[model samples]
Target: MTGPGQNPNGPGAGLPPVPSIPLTDETARDVAGEQSVGGLVKDVMTQVSTLLRAEIELAKIEVGAEVKKALRGSVFFILALTIVCFSLFFLFFAIAELLADLGLYRSASFGIVWVAMLVTAGLFGFLGYRKVRRLRAPERTIETIKDTAAALRHPGEHS
Candidate 1:
């Protein structure tokens, strides 16, 4: 029966019949014989295995890159921190020297300098502790990889 965008009999009702490309029985058999269900399953399994292997390798590479980046960033941060600490130390020493020159050292100059140095050290130590905690915190990507690997190794284990 005719439908929308279709001829009443079939497609191309008014056109000449298209020439068919005849294939020999042997050719047809050869083409069809290679496409069994088992072969198709094997092909799919191979592809899945290949894709999984590539994904795993890529994950490993990314993890390594992330670790390297974190290390470099930490190194740079530590270096900058060291520079800042030294600068503060020098600044405090200069202040102490200025106080001594102004004859304030005989009064409470040493106490002030000592208190300032201790306070600065304590503040910086706290900040460093916080930074270290942040740096050592568990990464989401690493956690995801762990989860994925566990799932791949033992399917249906996660609840």
Candidate 2:
């Protein structure tokens, strides 16, 4: 659901921001002993793990919300489309009658109208099929997740 120019990993993408869990500064100069450093590393690791889990949860929640909205919208869209299709019968009937009034055989006029409607439906269905075929995975979101993973792996390196 990232908008135009909005970073996939930005605040908007993960509305519920990560909790304020303080992570240890691994670069801190004050290191009393190796034991303390190990404890520090452990603490940092735990914090990072928690942060990663939280970020994942945020992603799941956001995606779920967007999916629910799409599902609901599609349901309404289908309902509207169904109604429109049914309503089109009257309009096409009027067109057929008009054709018949123009000196064409009544059966011929109705046949032509039916054929035209079928061709139009086929054209639209083909276009919809093409659109569906062109659907792709969310590359930006995948890239953002990769970047986050890289950042987490190399905490000392700044990108």
Candidate 3:
């Protein structure tokens, strides 16, 4: 006979009673190794391994939190980008319409708008290219490498 979902003749019913053992630090130390110099070394190694595992777990948790923050910030950046793109599209249309109302044909007005955009793009591109070209080598790193090469070449010259 069983009560509710319980089975009287279940898999665990006929199992032998398991003995409980008291676990303590001394027991753990004794089970790991005998009291000797080798045992001391083994204990130290085990403690170091435990410490490294805890440090690695802490690093993983910190990195996970940083990734979550970056992802949250990215959502807001994406929303701002979408809104800005739509606003630019409407502004372009409005500029073209204004030009057409000033007596130009609609097609010509749109073409003028496109040409103006291309000129602006070209100006920005040229400025960006100049800035990139101006980026120089790391002076301190180059100097350090040069010093190292000189030292290697003339090792006996140093006092």
Candidate 4:
């Protein structure tokens, strides 16, 4: 069903059609409400609550879809990491063999492998630290929230 201001012939046209109920005397009376301040406030609160619930449900659905996508992506990364681990194991062994063939002792060749692994680990650690340092709060969302608060505090003032 199309929402307020939405085009009826747009994408939402494919959705289930809203039921057509004839406005009989009984139905009209049921639809009408007491014309009082308290009634108006209660009606507004009910609408707001319903809108909030719909928004929360939409968020949950969107988040679930995103999490599913992330899980699928993680599977591919895990497979890649597994293959790379095995490839690195063989690569280090091959390098050690090459060093030994070049007249270095087997122990010395393996010692070089240990040093190389340590250096690689240190480089990764440093990169991770730098990435962590670059992390910051959501600046735009914070700014928008501040603006909303200001507008609410002074309804007549435009910020």
In the range 16-65, model 2's lDDT, one tens digit per residue, is 44554664675545554345768879977887777677667656766666
lDDT of 3 by residue, 1-159 (tens): 444665568842533323222345667766676778887789766755654454445445445555655565555445545554554664577665764655666655665666665555555555545544544444433454466467658867863
| Better-scoring candidate (lDDT), 2 or 4 | 2
lDDT per residue for candidate 4 within 1-159, as digits (tens), equals 567877888843534433322344646666685458888788756755654454445445445555655565555445544554654675577665664655666655665666565565555555545544544444433454466457658869964
Model 4 alpha-carbon drift over 4 Å, by segment = 1-33, 99-159
Error of 1 at 105 (Å): 13
Candidate 1 residue lDDT tens string, 16-70:
3322223446577677668889987897677557655655555555566556556
Per-prediction TM-score, please? 0.38, 0.48, 0.42, 0.43
Candidate 3 regions exceeding 4 Å error are 1-34, 99-159
- At residue 63, candidate 2 shows an lDDT of 65
lDDT (0-100) at residue 100 of candidate 1?
60
Angstrom error at residue 83, model 4: 1.2
lDDT for predicted candidate 2 compared with the true structure: 0.62
RMSD of each: 17.0, 6.8, 20.0, 9.3
By lDDT, is 1 or 4 better? 1
**TM-score of predicted model 3?**
0.42
Candidate 1 residue spans exceeding 4 A from truth? 1-32, 102-159
TM-score of 4: 0.43
Clashes of 3: 0
